[model samples]
Target: MDFAFTPEEERFREELHQLLLTNLPGDWAKRGLAEPIDSEERHALADLLSKQLAERKWLTMAWPEKFGGLDASYLMQYLFNEEMAYLDAPGGGGVGVTSVGPAIMMYGSEEQQRIYLPRIANADDRWAALYSEPGAGSDLASIQTRAVRDGDEYVINGLKTWVAGADRATMGWLAARTDPNGPKHRGLSTFAVPMDDPGVEIRPIENLAGERQLSEVLLHDVRVPIENRVGPENRGWYHVASTLDFERSGVASYARGKRHIEQLVDLVKENSTLSDQRQAVRYELADRWIELQVGFNVAQRIPWLQTQGISPNHEASVSKVYGSEMTQRIAGTGVRLLGMAGLLQRGTDGAPAGGAFARHYLTSAGSTIAAGTSEIQRNIIAQRGLGLPR
Candidate 1:
């Protein structure tokens, strides 16, 4: 029940901070580099930082030793992530560390492990995920992308929108239907595909924030070697879903929220705000801070569950939904605090804090929808966590 970091963990956090101090661009924090976005420049900068994280073996330090890791504990990995978020560092797509690498380690061919793990651990490659389709997003069982087996390969053909960081990805983790019959989930399969294949195309999509946050991917006659399959054919639903645990767990960043809260508090304190809501807002801020702390406490429990070899399906979902919603709430509050100025985005004259909060207000519109919709997470909590009926 202890909430404190051990001395060693503290040391590791300090080490990470030192790494950021030395390796981050001189004006990195000034450039709004901490926010997640995808552009040629953003990805390239993140790629460099990721490589730096890899050199210290901190990127994938908790993985098995044979696959380019040092066999560190899960707490170390958790601490590393906490530091990254606290500093607002570029976590990139994190597809490699979060889902792709773990999926391969669990269900990939030995050859697949030998080929991909080292590059991923070393930050020599980036990966995009193609899971959601136009018709099937929240319910992945409805995926329509198809990969038909042909001789020594599978030919992939379909479209995937919102493929994060596709512009910088050298490869993609794809889920497709390999069979047209049987249960909706059973006919699917997973594959690792080259992002630059002649039959694959990636185009950028701008979010309301006016930033290229996602990409639309088109695949036609994309041939992937059978050797690239992650698990047995027609069972990709399991392989891909196994790692949703990874996605669902350990994603909330209390540090980021805490930092954001601090920023707003400092702004209000320094300026003799005009409105009486300043005092009222102070109380509201305290209540919201308490909510964020609750979310953080919930998030902490997931790491403990992980260490104990438990998944806590509902607990993770609870944290995920709460954290996503909490962030959106924080951004909304910022918009209200800034009033008309809040509406002004960056690059406009007199936009406060370079209009970061305004941009965040727009970008956060996607937060609840990304990993899983907030509503979906609640459903998970009800059914899986609370043992409610389907």
Candidate 2:
């Protein structure tokens, strides 16, 4: 494979970089991308940035033109994500743009698409993925959330934890058990629940990084019209698997690691006091850079496969596992290189890199666990990618 972006793609990347350069706040680098959206100020900034990206039709560029997108190639979309991560630019659309909208496009009905896609594409509504439960994180098929049919609606009752951005979302991309007696994997269904429903409640959770970006969402008899269900009844397990594939196949994590690695390299070069330590750790730094490149190459293959009309399943898992663990390794190295100073939180006086590395070290702790656990990803790779026995 060429592994090279075409001339047009390269130009597109440059154009995107210029746009980010002009639009991103001057102090964004210091504030860093890993900072949690714990403040209303940050939320407002994110909303503003999302709107700007939506206005340019860059928020959902990979979707078809009929769905308020630019009909961009998968590679173009990957390039856009790469640039966004490298710059730590906010408002590039979150799960709504990446997984939820794409899932709706694939499995939602025509009416469903018309109702949700435009709002998602326009950044008019934020979405929270209500998939993970206290007992059903990696084993999502085991989720016990119940959605019972009630005439023309489904009454949902469940608790979803670790729901990122739930407080800010207007809608929830939900998964619930529609058939309790059937097999775990076969009895599930998906729905689009309104976050503002009377029975919906959100309780904020602060992560290790002191960010309230994660939360617990409680649904008590929350009802949605039958039209809200996505895909087929009792097939949500498969539908969500497809959505997970969409969530995992991205260059963002690798690009973020690249930025941090570059920052660490610059710190080593400029700080004369670290000259002795730098010589000792030069090979370690070199290895991280190489691993990051390898992960990027792995991720690039997913979009390439998509361009060829192939749906990458286990390949997405490969990229997710490698990229996520690679980030953890980079974060560890950053903390080691900075020593005690690395432990300082953001805004502390004299913290290195505005304490970005320290904050990242905390945030990246769950990289291997979120989306899908490393164990689950490996199982998918072994069973699906290698065609091994169950």
Task: Find the candidate with the highest TM-score and give its number.
Answer: 2
lDDT of 1: 0.81
Q: Where in model 2 is the C-alpha error above 4 Å?
A: none
Clashing pairs in 1: none
Q: What does the lDDT come to for candidate 2?
A: 0.88
What would the TM-scores of all predictions be?
Answer: 0.95, 0.97
**Highest lDDT against the true fold, candidate:** 2
Clashes of each: 0, 0
Model 1 lDDT tens row, 150-221:
999999999998888887789999999999887988999999999989999988998897778689999999
lDDT of 2 by residue, 281-352 (tens): 798899999998898899999999989888899999999899999999999999898788878877799778
lDDT of candidates 1 onward, in order: 0.81, 0.88
